[model samples]
Structures are given as C-alpha cells and as structure tokens.
Target: MATLNSDYLIIGNSAAGVTAAETIRAKDPYGTITLISREPHHVYGRPLISYLIEGKTTLDAMKFKPETFYEDHKITALLGDEFEALTLDPEAHEVGLKNGDSIGYGRCLLATGSVPFTPPIKGLQGKSNVFTFITLDDAEQAWAAAVEASLKASESGRCSRVVVIGSGLIGLKAAEALSHHLDEISVLELADRILPTVLDPEGSALLQRLLEPHGITCYPGLTADEVLGEGDQAVGVRLTNGECLDCDLIIAAVGVRPNSSLALEAGAQSGRGLIVDERLLTSLPDVYAAGDVVQVCDVLDGSEHPLALWPNAMHQGKIAGRQMAGDETALFHGSFAVNAVDFFDISLLTAGVINPREDMGCEIDIYAEDNSYAKFVKQDGKLIGYILLNRPQNAGIYTALIENGVDLDSLDQDIFLETPQNLDFDNEMRWERLHKFYPRDLDRRGWKEKI
Candidate 1:
C-alpha cells in the first residue's frame, strides 16, 4: 500500500485516458500527472483488434502513440491496476484508491470506459469456450481459441463452426474473422436488422450481400435462448425458434454497458453512464468523467446518450484534461454518433441525427439507387442529419453542414433531390459555408487569394 501525490490523477488508459494525458501535458507541462490502467500494454487502438484477429496487422503497429509516450511527456504510468473505488474529499482535495493507497490531486478524471454486456442466457455460465471480444486480452483469448478449434477439427476430422451473438460492428467483424478458418459461421441478432441503431434497412441489405459471398450467414430477428454445451465447453446455441446450430466457438458481441460502478459508489450521478457537464465535469467538484463510461448530451437530439465512438472519447478526454489543468479553453461539444464500417467489398458511413420521427415536423429527403442512397433530414431550415451509403466522398461535406447547423432553406431543394453526383456547390450559401469550414483548402485552391 503505497501513497502517491500528483497534480492530476487519471484512471483508465485507453482512448480517453491517453488523450487526457497529452492534453494535460500540452497545457501544464510542469504539473505531475499520473495515469492508471488495468491493461498491461500501453495505449493501443482497440478498433484494430478485428484486423489483428484476421492477420491484417501486427500488435506493434496498433500502438496509439509510441512506447515511450508517457516518459516523453514526463508522466507517471501505472499499468495492471484496477480502479476499485473513488472517494473524494473536497476539503483535502484528495482521492482514495482501493489499493489501500491515497492520491492527493488537484484534479481527477474518470475514464474507466465500459464492459461488454453478456446477457444471461440459459447454459451460458460455466461454459469454457464462450468468449467476448472487448479488451486486448479478450481478443487474444478469442483468437487463440479460434485457432485451437480450427486445429482440433482438422486433426480429429470434425466440422468447425462459430456462432456470433450480435449484429453490431464487433459481432460482424468477429463473424468475418472466424469465417476465414471455420467451416461455417452464423451471426445471431435479436434486432430486425444488422446495425439496427446505425444503418437502415437498405444499408444492411448491402452488408448482407457482401457477407454472403464469404460464407457468413446472418440470422436477424432471432434471439439466443440457450448456450448448448457438452461438459464445460460450449458446443452450439439454441435459437428462440427452437433451432440448434452446431458451433465449436461462440463469441458474444451483445453490446457494452458503461463501467460506472465506482462512480456510483462514490455518489456520482449515474444514468446510462456517468453524467457529465459540458466541461466534462461530473456532479462532484474536481471530479471529471469521459470516454464510454460517461453519458453525454447529443448535440443534435438534446437527449443524453452514450457515445462509444473512439474519436468522441478522445475529444471528450481532451476537453476534460484542459479543464482539469486550470485552463477553460475547451468544452466537450458532444458527439454526433458517427460510425463507418468496411466489410468484404462494401463500405458505409453515417453521421449526425438519424431516423427522424415523422411526427417531429422534420422534412426527409432521399436519393436512392440499387448501389447507394443518400438521405437528409432538415428541421427548421437547418440540416439535422444524413446517411450515406456506398458513396463516401461527400460525407464530410454533409457532416459539416449538419454539425454547424448551416441554413439550407436558401439552397435549391432540387440539389438534394437529385443524385449526389449531380449536386453542385455553386450556390452562394453552400459555397460560403463550405469555404468557411475548409478555409485552408479554399486558400490552396486560390479561392481565398482573390478575396
């Protein structure tokens, strides 16, 4: 039980924690900074785990920064340490740790992130071969198990199959990875379509077509009733429709829930995630929260939602870091829940508000084709949301318009009605907004030179 003292103490060391450290160093280079992480490895991009499983990249390449990032910034690193509790003392400006140690901090950040939510299906417990793909360790174990299952089937002359329970990004990636080695692969989703919260029906159809060529079967609108196992190892799963599929590997990608238990125990306000203000500060003073562990306001919807995107986490972390370092230079402007996915030969990108309610007095416009579709939602003369499929080049432009609340009423509605290719930005209003956002590009194009 050792004690530590630092000007800033950060718990968790993935996207949010790492960004916070760099931001703090950027603002206050002389302050003592301590970062604690339960992971043994330094900061690495978690999204690359799927590529690693598919043998597309090596572990070394996935390092977020460099091995010496902490040392280079004169920051103390604590690896393989879990944050068990948080006890704040306002008068002393100190926090108590579960390791029987205390840290005296002028400011503290909670970036504890989230944990995979594995539903309690019958026979799921005590299964040796069932795994979840979340952490690096989780990916390592799943990859190893997949390899072993493949080898055993080859040596013992048995069929190898894998059932992935979820149709979200993680589940799809896992199914793709297992499809490379397994004899058969199936994805089970309780929702009516894949990527229910992200992609619409047409977008999901394109994805399904891409997966079919790779021998991945998707069973949407189906729920897992039980994990069928022989002895201690999972052998298959029983579907709610009374269908049993034989599988040697089972990867649970049901989704994730914010890990806010410590914050809750510390009397911090908790909703779907730790509630934080615009400054990323929690209800408690000198205590801040970010990353997937915090519920942030959706700038578009004006409702609290969990933005689990990596970029959102990093941005939130930077804001929290700056505010904690005594610089009120930034605010967590919130996230638009943007996400992109590339599988097989199809690529999809979506951002901002989605699925506008028909009764919300919003106008919806769509341009659809067999290969692509662009949908835009306008409310009160402002662009609210957009969905782009197959065509990704103009996504940035649409995202900017929606995020900046650019007025679209003056522009010709026919521009959005036509195919994205037929659209032109010659309109004064559109050009003005576009140039404002891309001033450097405009300068490079000599458009600003004449002005």
Candidate 2:
C-alpha cells in the first residue's frame, strides 16, 4: 500500500474542508496540506447545483475558490477517492482510503457533509431513473434524464411531468430548476405546510401561494406510498392518502443524513451528528470535525443541534482550520438553524427558533404587508427568532439582534414594519456593533441602512 505524510489531512474537499485548508494555509505558510475529495472536480459551492440545472451557471464557475487555489497554497490534492476507514494510532495518526492509499498526519479533519435520505416506498428500490437531488453529479444526472424524458414524451404528444418528493429547500430548488424545462411540476411534503422545518404554517402558506402562480403546486401532508414504475424506471407515484399522479421523473429531496460512519468507526462521539467542541475538535485527540457532519451548540435553546446553513458551514470550517493550525484563540460565536430561500418572486429568510411554541411561554409578534411580512419571537425578554419574507434589507439586522440576545422589553414593534436603526439597539450595543461591522470607506449615513 502506498503511504503519504502531511501536517494536515482533510477528509472532504467541499465547503468546510476547503475553508479549513485556506485558513490553515494562512496560519502555516509552508506546512504540508493534503485534501481528499470523493468527487472528481475541485471544491465548489454545493448550493449552485440547482443553478447548474437551471442553466444560470456552468460547472466551471461553481468553484468556491479560484482554480489556482490549491496550487497557490502548495496543497497536495487527491480527488475522486473515497475514504474507507480512519485509524488513529498512538505513535502516528493514519487514515486509510478506499483507493488503498494510507496517509499519516499531525492532525485530521472530517467534513464529509451529508447524504440524501431516500425514504423506502414500495416499488422505489432499484429504480434506475429515480434520483436524489443533492450533489452536482445528482443534479447533472437528473437534468439529463428530465430533458430526455420530456423529449421522448413529446414524441407521443404527451407533456412530461416531474414529481419532487419534498417541498423543503432541496426539493423546491429542484422543482424550480426542472420547471424551466418541463411542463408540469409537483412537490410533495409529508407535513401540512411547505418548509415545515424552517417556516410556520403562515410563512409556508405565503411561500406556497407565491409559487403556485408559476405552474408549481405543492401538495402538503402527503407522501409516496409506492413508486409506480415499469421495469427499472419510474412512471408515477401513489401517495399514502390513496392519490396517484403520473410523472416522468422522480427527484427525492426528503433531506440528508450526516455522513459520520467514519467518525463513529474512529471512536468519536455521535448523536444526530458527530459531537464537537467549540473549537470544532472531535472526541478523539488530534482529530477535528465541522460542517454538516458535526453538531454544534444552538444559540436559541442552548442545546446541540445541526446548524446546516452554508454560512455556518463556512464559519465552522474556518474555526477547525485555525485550531488545526495551532491557533486556539479562534472560537465560534454560536450556530443555529437558519435558511434563506427564494421561491418564484418572493424571498424569505428564517432563523433560530422559527416556530415559537406558545406553551413555552414565547411571546410572538407579527407584521404583514402586501408582498412583505415579518415575525418575531421573544422569550425571557430577549429576541429568540424571526422570519422575514420579501424583505432582504432587514435580515442582517434582525439576525444580529437575535445573536446578541438583545432584550426586547424596550424594543419598538414598529421596527418590524421598516428597516431597524442603530437607535433601535441601546447606546452601548450600538457602539459595539458599529465598531465591529462598520465599513471603512462608507460614511455613517450611507452605512446605517446596512445595520
């Protein structure tokens, strides 16, 4: 077996892994850095897969960094290799790859991300045409298959329909992209509301109503009981509620499971995901984890939960990378479940404790206008959560207030109706936030809008 040695070994090459690598390079200029990737291409923003299918951008432009990034940092790249096992030795920390290569490292990071969760429905197994909507490869396969299916159906004078089994982020994005090429698109969700995990019934209703005008219908509170198919290809789906719909393509976006078997095999702790410290260090010494594969502290309830947002992943990767490079001062602020999505013409951003339970003594305030809406939840006199729709400019300010635990006793409810000002925050908090986020060149008058 071939063996290699490096100062740092990264198990995945996507968002968190790439961020860690760049941070490590910044801290240690000449250290040996080895990055392993299961995919064939360089690190790219995974969220762009939907855009790729929509023809908004090509695969070349999906990279998270420049093409010369790895070369510029003198990092050794190992692409298209799956990691099989992680073996931590007392004398030498080593990792085994499926390609029969072994790597010895001073420290290692696992940012393996997550895999799509395909719920088992009758007649769904072994269907060649049924695909998951997660990876870039998955997007490419689905896009090709959709086009071919539609064209073939056109020969028979029939319109092609696509059934996306979920109305969450992944499913909605897939449906949006497929709508560009296909005539009919339908999204199925097991919950009564679309985006149930991120948005409440009202917010979900608003999003669904906005999308319905664009030829996409969301069927909530129903799921596939059976995937009706001929041979190895799917033709339609039978819902659990005894409704059958015909479709040419089946794209499953039910959600994802963290790829953390390697972490468990390495004797690291695992919950819903691999448990990591504030430093992004795993249970095992000299091994770290970040991104979707690791669960971090949630700022809202003070419990460990998966904060699967892209910004959280990027920040986690930076913390892990800095720690691996011998910088212990780098600490994560906190992480919370958050999502920002655009459905048709409406843009929505939700974060922290989105749906506050009245049973939990949560005080909820709502403000709704035509094509614009805002909701805030306050608990223990502090901002706990918020949801904003068709209001992009106010998102950052609300997020900051929630993160900082600003007391809402003196807060103006009118702030929800318009852009909040620095005056909305107290004098001390205002000065602190201004000093922290104030731009260098932009004057105060021009910059307060951004706060």
Candidate 3:
C-alpha cells in the first residue's frame, strides 16, 4: 500500500537485476534504487545449481552477493513480491504495480529472467511425483523428493528409479543429482545426442562414455508422450514409441521460455522474448529489458536470439545499467553459446558460434580420439568457434582469440595443441595488447616477469 519514488526501478533479482542494481549504484551514488523479485532468496548463481546437487557447494555459498549487499549499496530490495502488472504513464513517467502501489522512476529495467517450458503432455498436471527444474524452490523440492523416495525405498526394500526428460544441461544435472540418492537414474533426450545445441555428435559420444560409469542411463532420440500416473502420483513415463518406463520420479528439463507476458500485455514489443534495441531498451520509453526475457543480438550472426546463459544476463544487465545512468556506452556484443561441464572425470569446454552451414565457406579442423576430441571452425582467416573435450586447459586463450577476431594465421595451430603454458606471447605487439587488456596480470608480475 506504500507508494515509492526512485531514481531507478529494477524488476527480477537474477543475474541481470543484481548486476544492474550494483552498476547503477556505482555510477549514481545518490540515486535511489528499488529492486523487486518474486524469489524469496537473494541473488545466486544459476550455474552453480548443478554443483549444488554434487555437494560441491551449499545454498549460502551459491549466493552471488551477501545478504547485506543491498543495504550497503543503499538499494531497496523487495523480495517475495511479484510484479504482476505494469502500467506505464508517459506524462507522469511512473509505473503501477499489482500490489496497489505506484513507483515514479527516472529509469526502469525489466530483468524478469525466464521460466521453464513444460510441454503439453497428457496426465502431467495430475501427477504429483513429476517435477521441473528451474527456480531455487524447484531445486529444493526436487532434492527433497529424491531424498524422500530414496529413504522410503531403503526402509521398505523397494526399488527407487528416476527418469529425467530432456538431455540438456538441466536434465543432465538433475539426473546426476538423482543418481546420488537413487539406484536407477535415466535421462531421455529427444535429440540424437546430449547438449545438441553446444556439442556435436563426437563430443556427446565422449560425454556419454564418461557418464555411463556413474550409473546414469542415457536414452537419446526418445520423446515423452505422456506422464503415467497411478491415482495422483506419477509412476512412470510413456514415450512416443509406445515404450513405458517404470520409475518413482520424473523430472522434466525440456527448456525455458522468457517470462515476458507482462511486458507483452503492457504493449511492449516481444517475440521469442521481449524485443529490444542495442541499448537493451524496449519499444516503451523508460522501460528497458535484459536477461533471458529479452532477445539479444548474436555477435556472429548479427541476428536477435535468445541466449539463456547466466553470464550473458549479467553482462547485458551491466550494459543496461550504464546506459540508463546516462552513459553512452555501446550495446552489449552478443554472446556465443559457451559451456563448461564435467561428468565423472572428463571435462568439456565449448565456445563461440556452432553448427556450421554445409554450403557456407568455412575451414574445419578436427582432432578426434576415443577419449577426446577438439574441433575448430574458421571463416575469413578468423577463429569463429571451437569445441574441446577432456582437454580444457587452453579454453580461455581460444575464447579470447575468437571473441577479439584475432587472426589465427600468425599463430601455429600445433602450438595450441599443447598445454596453455606452452603458448608464447613473446611478440612485442601481442604482449602489449594482451597486457593492456589484462592489466592486473601485468601489475602482479612486472611486464618483464613473464616474457
């Protein structure tokens, strides 16, 4: 019921919102900032959710910032409150919230993030044992349900089996988590291979070999037709091929869709996500958008696309915040679908543009083995993309080279085949450029220290 006036108002508390709040506070110290989130907890790293399942980190450790961050930055954080509706008044430069309150803001940012996409499969709604992995609440519920099923089975001498739909990062992580508690865990992917968007068939095959020893079953090219339930709880899943797999739990990890309905209903331009300009500004004046809710331009294709990565959200938020604070910084350079994931002992790192056109002119170099593979795609003498498995040491160097459009002709490809330590930056111009960008490295060890 309380009205508020702020210099800036940010919606959602994910990577984008958190970074936007901090960036704005850094630029405009005296400007009042209000951050609203539907989530109850403070901002946390979404990528670490998988590690959390592996017991690599606890909930507190996943927090991106401390609980007192907002207080210290003089930002008002509204947790556990949903921004149900958005009504814009151009004359007053104000927005009305569903909580019967209005906020007058000099600038507004919509970092609403995204929501998991649940396919329209029959018997899904009535099933209590079926779940989706997305929010913190979803992770907590999944963990609790998995543990409970395991414990109950242990007590009653019954079998506990879990089926995970979708073979992307979320499904893989969920399967890994369930494997820790349940004896039988299977991942069913609709595509021919896992991580179809990021990794090629060769890379997926290597990962499958690594995961097979961990008691995780991988079923590729299988589609879920319906959720099979007894009474009100899901007991198994019915596949499109008429195969029914009995299981105690089913976790759906198909994908996520941008939560941009509010923006659309408010008359903001939207497509797969809220459409925005290079500056992350929506069609509505004073209403900027970022994070997974907005479609961002891809650096390689120069086309608007949805990249739901956490780093992309954070970087986009920084750009939005800076522009909102009256800085004329350029729009965010689009992101490549880069990922670093590990299962068992093998690690995989993928970066830059992927899926080369068959007819398009591009050079492809591949080094494949039974245990690992490395591939690079180049166009116009510039490194465009790469995929590395089991050999992740020099990933940063490749990422830098690809991002900066560095001419790879001067560097020997064989040099990169070795460890990152073997690479030489003795050339004065290269060293100077690298040093200027990574000044901290230069300061730590005087420029002459590493040669």
TM-scores, all candidates, are 0.90, 0.93, 0.92
Off by over 4 Å in 2: 82-92, 409-413, 426-429, 436-451
Q: What would you estimate as the lDDT of candidate 2?
A: 0.84
Tens digits of per-residue lDDT, candidate 3, 1-451, equal: 2288888989888899989999988899999999887787888887777678779899999999997899999989887755543566644767777777787888889898888898788887867788888877878888888889988888889878898988888888888777888888888889999878888888788787788888888888986888888898898888888999888888989988998876776788887788888888998888888899988777876667788888788888999999888887757766776778776577888887666877658888888878888888888988788888888886887887788887776676574565543244436546665556565545535663555
* Pick by TM-score: 1 or 2, better one: 2
Strongest candidate by lDDT:
2
| C-alpha RMSD values across all candidates | 3.3, 4.0, 3.4
Candidate 1: Cα lDDT at 291 = 95
| Decoy 3 TM-score against native | 0.92
Relative to the true structure, candidate 1 reaches a TM of 0.90
Q: Write the per-residue lDDT of candidate 2 for residues 1-451, one digit (tens) a residue.
A: 3299999999888889999999999999989999987787888889999888888888889888899999998889888746444454523588877777789888999888988887878898898888898788899999999899889989999888999999889999999999888888989999998988888888888888888877798999998999999999899999988989999989999999888887787688888889888888888888898898888778787777666678888999999999999999998766787678776667888888987766769988888886777888888888788888887775778888788777765566567668877677666667777687667766656654445
Residue 438 lDDT in model 1? 67
**Distance from true position, residue 294, model 2, in Å?**
0.6
